[model samples]
Target: MGDRNGCSTPGGGGSALSVMAGAVIGAAGLAWWLLSEAERRRQQPRQPRSLRLSTLRTPVPAEVGTGTSSEPHERDLHDRVHELNQAIDDVRRQLESMNTQA
Candidate 1:
């Protein structure tokens, strides 16, 4: 009942429809991947930034009993502290660069 391509002969009681469907889907996926590769290759490479810093924010201290167990609040505090540390490091680097240049 099956042809060489594994598709059933017409009215031969096999999975001709499924075989054709699979072929169509495979072709579409291949075409998509090729197009994506071409587009990516066409884009120019990017240069790294000389300096980067996150925006400064005045941190509000956690309230004594506002539930320190809240996950989002803890995450926010952690992120804020990290940004502050990064800013401090940037300032130190700038100072060192200035001293070296002078």
Candidate 2:
């Protein structure tokens, strides 16, 4: 309870003055934090962050690559495989021809 002279006795269980003081201090703290952030942003303006994109491309079978797919890496791989198979077939034919001659 306050005295007749209008002075708070500080034991009246959270007087209006304490509440006002707490509100003012909280407001000042918030204002200070906002100003610091603004100053930091002004010194180094926010840049657009670049996100890295990841590819999940894994090599499948050559036959799987050749039919309907048109990716360059897959097509190249399929062609190289086809060339190797053709070379192997030619070597087998030559060896058979030699064996027959013997």
Candidate 3:
């Protein structure tokens, strides 16, 4: 079968035209959406310099150390050191046991 305008294939011309039109419409829609989004972002309210400076000038509260001890920082450090010593002892015992077995 042949198409009008003396073409050999059927429906080829109409399909190609439809594809081109769809692509053009899709491109136009994407461009419009991007431009609108950019315009909206440009129109948004920016943070005032005075508000930003004030926030920067405010003093932050002192951070409290973790743990329930009276001297939290010293107690935390002591506990950590004790834990490390215990771990060292455990490793030494393991090494001794391995040497005896060998």
Candidate 4:
């Protein structure tokens, strides 16, 4: 531990104090570097984005007749159309079942 220069040996009070001072300076340097890096990151310019427009069509009912018609008749027509579709589907399913059995 004694490198004879009349100075204190390694692991003595002076050496220990010197090592602690070195450690403190190192830590302070690391902290300053981190803060400067953060500042540099904040100063960087952001990229501008271009928004592309989408073309999508939505289906809406055509306005043909004005409101002079009976509401009950309109409802009856809608129900009849629905029932016809169901009947057609049932007939198709029965035909498919019969064909498979055959």
Candidate 5:
């Protein structure tokens, strides 16, 4: 038959242009994919070191209080302080008794 160029379909001349165009399109698609992957990595949230238990492992004393110091916190703090003082007195009496026995 004959192509639209009317050359009777000999070898081919425009085939190289088609190959180059396809290569350009493929390269552009690859570039876009790489950019999208990079953007996804950028948008990902990072893991906070402070949220880990090991990072917050401070040695707290046994008789220490752990109440919030906000305003509106009234009776709870007073009750805790009173209870802690009683416990401390009880321990002191026990230690004094042991010392007297020795």
Candidate 6:
């Protein structure tokens, strides 16, 4: 019997084996290409770690309102907020004392 392409049956020739070998070679080539591409990417120099504003540890300004303090200290967000609140309270107290004296 003949196939759709009018090719004779597998018993007439080793067409089946040839097709299988071609498929195997194609698969191997694809795998090799993928591996080489991966290796090429691995060899390329990676981009340097980009600087992010969020990651930066900018020093907190000292004494909230005076605007005169130049010294800055590296403190985390929570601690810096606490310090600001304390400075605000201190200023309030100072204002009250001045008012009472007046």
> What C-alpha lDDT values do all the predictions have?
0.73, 0.74, 0.82, 0.75, 0.75, 0.74
Alpha carbon deviation, residue 73, candidate 3 (Å): 48
Model 6: clashing residue pairs?
none
Q: Tens-digit lDDT track for model 6 on 29-77?
A: 9999999999878766442223344335566445768654543433466
Candidate 4 structure quality by residue, lDDT tens digits, 1-102: 356754566557787789999999999999999999998777654322111112123343455577544565799999999999999999999999999999
- Candidate 2 C-alpha lDDT tens digits along 1-102: 457645655554466768889999999999999999999887663432221111224554354544655576778999999999999999999999999999
lDDT string for model 5 (1-102, tens) is 469775755456577668999999999999999999998777654445444555579654343356544423567788889999999999999999999999
Find the 10 residues in a row with the least total lDDT in model 4.
Answer: 47-56
TM-score of every model versus the real structure: 0.33, 0.32, 0.38, 0.35, 0.35, 0.34
Q: Which candidate ranks first by lDDT, i.e. highest?
A: 3
Name the top TM-score candidate.
Answer: 3
lDDT of 4 at 85: 100
**Candidate order, lDDT descending:** 3, 5, 4, 2, 6, 1
Model 5 ranges off by over 4 Å: 1-11, 46-102
| Off by more than 4 A, model 3 | 1-7, 46-102
Backbone clash tally for model 4?
0
> lDDT for model 5, on a 0 to 1 scale?
0.75
Q: Which model, 2 or 6, shows the larger lDDT?
A: 2
The TM-score that candidate 2 achieves is 0.32
Total backbone clashes of candidate 1, pairs 3 or more residues apart or in separate chains: 0
Whole-model alpha-carbon lDDT for candidate 4: 0.75
